[model samples]
Target chain A: NAGVTQTPKFRVLKTGQSMTLLCAQDMNHEYMYWYRQDPGMGLRLIHYSVGEGTTAKGEVPDGYNVSRLKKQNFLLGLESAAPSQTSVYFCASSSRWREGVNEQFFGPGTRLTVL
Target chain B: AQSVAQPEDQVNVAEGNPLTVKCTYSVSGNPYLFWYVQYPNRGLQFLLKYITGDNLVKGSYGFEAEFNKSQTSFHLKKPSALVSDSALYFCAVRESTSNTGKLIFGQGTTLQVKP
Candidate 1:
């Protein structure tokens, strides 16, 4: 299986620009998440969906929004780019907690730079 | 609030010698701990997880972590280090009461193995 894949491996944007990141997983997971990785800081959860059509805010969700229109796909959107949002973004998926706190599978990550 | 901490920003070790990565966690109830590794320009990869039963959890790439409830620690260890093992390591924790399976991640620790 391809596991999880992210589109737009690299991007550069100016302030006030907008973009969307695409994440797709073939594992049929029930949960999906978006996170950003900055130097010296570990990955922080941006948003997550418990299932299709359900999304919720996470630890760092101020500049980001997300949607899970399909069970296998999760999308993260930046309404207006900011320098603080420039970081490596990652998407992950995992089974439900009832399945025993399963480890999340991550994508290759998208490197974004906002000027 | 649930949280994880990696006190060391970086750790240097010689190849063929044992290595340990320290991690500590805080949570109200039982904690589900995990370790992940990130190679340069790559997404984070799951290393190991501690849920229940055995205190010593073995994972991919000859890595093992011991869960110490008394100390609220889960330290990653390998019998012998390899230059290839050099990477950034993250420690994460999820509260057992959380149904969404949200994880709190540490700041990450860089492991540098010299030949």
Candidate 2:
């Protein structure tokens, strides 16, 4: 089903440079999330969408923005990239709001390095 | 705020031996706990989760976890370890007042299964 896929497996950005990460899922999930994984830090949610045309802030949403204009796609944007934003970013999707039974399906991940 | 703790930084076990990865969490109410595995340079994959019902929850890759509500712990276990089982393990918890279903992850535990 292709499950979840992310564009640009790796990226390097200069400080102040802006960029967008694209995440697409073919599973028709109702929920999508953006998370960053730093060494020793498992994963931290940056933003999420409950459904199309909806977005919400997560635990660490300071430097990131997100949009879910379509049901199968979620995009994360960095207005001004910073060194602190260097990390592996993962995109995930779930069928519904409830977890456990509806565990998330993650993308291969996009590694970003901001200098 | 919900949080997850994976006490051990790393765990090593020989092939054919049983393996255990400890996890604990803190949340206001009932928590939806999850365990995920990540291979080198890859995104996390769902392993199992504990939401309700039985304390013993069985999941993928022949792994199981026992959820202890009183102790507030969910430990992942496998009867026989394999070299393929060597990877990074993450524990996560979901608790939301906004009902976004965002997840908070632990620092991660490295599992090394030697053959």
Candidate 3:
């Protein structure tokens, strides 16, 4: 299985530009998550989905939006890119949400640079 | 709210020596804790997690962590350090009360194992 895969491994965007980061998992997972990693900081959650057609905000959901239209895809959108949003973004999926029973599988990550 | 902390910014250990990465967490209810490792320019990999049951939970790459409820600490350990073990370590926590399945992470600790 491909597990989890992300689009645009690296991207450079200007302020106010908009783009969507695509995440797809072939594991038939039930939960999907979006996170950003900044220098010296742990990965901060941005958004997540419990199942298809459901999306929820995470710890740092501002400046971002997400959609999970299909079971295999979760997309994170930046309406207006900002310098603060420039970081490494990762996507993860889990078969379930229960503790001990859930182990997340992560993608290779997408490096975004907002100029 | 759930939060995690990694006291040390970086740890240096020689190859073949024992290594430990400290972590502490705070939560109102029963806490679910996890440890993840991130290699340079790479996404995070799940090292281990403690939900319930045993105090010492073993995980991938010869890594293990001890979950201390009283002390509210979960420290990652490896009997013999390897150069390959040098990377960034993260501690995360989630309150059992919340059903959002969101995780709060620490500021991250860099692990440096020298040969």
Candidate 4:
């Protein structure tokens, strides 16, 4: 299985440009998440979806929006990209939300450079 | 709020020697801890997790982690280090109180195994 896959491995955007990062999971997971990784900040959650048609803001969801139109797809959108938004974005999915037993599977990551 | 911390930025160990990457967490209720590994330019891979049963939990790539409830620690360990195991390790946790299903991650620790 492809597990979790992200579109556009790398992209460059000018200030104020908008784009969407697509995440697809074939594992039939019920929970999906979007996180941004900075040099020393580790991974910070931006938005998450518990199931299809359900989305919620996370720790760093201020400049981002997300939609889970289908169970296998979660899309992260940057309405007006800023230089501060330049970072590596990762998508992950999990089958459960109970506890340590539910391990998250991550995508290869999308490197975004907002110039 | 649930949070995780990885004290060391990097850990160096010789081949054939035991290695450890320390982690600590904070949560209101029962904590669910997890460890993940990331190779250069790749996505994070699941290692092991501590749910309920045993304090010591085994995971992929011959790695294990000890979960200490009193100390709120989950340290990743390996019996013998391998050069191939050199990578970035992350400690993560989720609070059992809320059902939002968001993960809190620590600043990653880079593991350097010298041959």
Task: Output the number of the TM-score-best candidate.
Answer: 1
Identify the superior model by DockQ, candidate 1 or candidate 2. Answer: 1
lDDT of 4: 0.93
Note the Cα lDDT for every prediction shown. Answer: 0.96, 0.91, 0.91, 0.93
- State the displacement of the C-alpha of residue B82, model 3, in Å, after optimal TM-score superposition: 0.4
- Model 1 residue A3 CA deviation (Å) reads 0.7
**lDDT tens digits, residue span A14-108, model 1:** 99999999999999999999999998888899999999999999989998988898999999999999999999999999999998789999999
Candidate 1 residue-wise lDDT, B1-115, digit = tens: 7889999999999999999999999999999999999999999899999999999999999999999999999999999999999999999999999999888999999999999
Candidate achieving the largest DockQ: 1
TM-score of each: 0.99, 0.95, 0.96, 0.97
Looking at model 3, what is the TM-score of chain A?
Answer: 0.96
- Give me the runs in candidate 2 sitting further than 4 Å from their true place: A98-101, B96-98
Badly placed stretches (over 4 Å) of model 4 are: A98-100
CAPRI grade, predicted model 1: high
Residue pairs with clashing backbones, model 3: none
Arranged by DockQ with the best first, the candidates are 1, 4, 2, 3
Assess the local accuracy of residue B86 in candidate 4 as a C-alpha lDDT between 0 and 100. Answer: 99
Q: State the DockQ of every prediction.
A: 0.88, 0.69, 0.65, 0.74
Docking class of 2: medium
Model 1 off-target regions past 4 Å? none
Q: What class would a CAPRI assessor give candidate 3's docking?
A: medium
For residue A3, give model 3's deviation from the true position in Å: 0.9
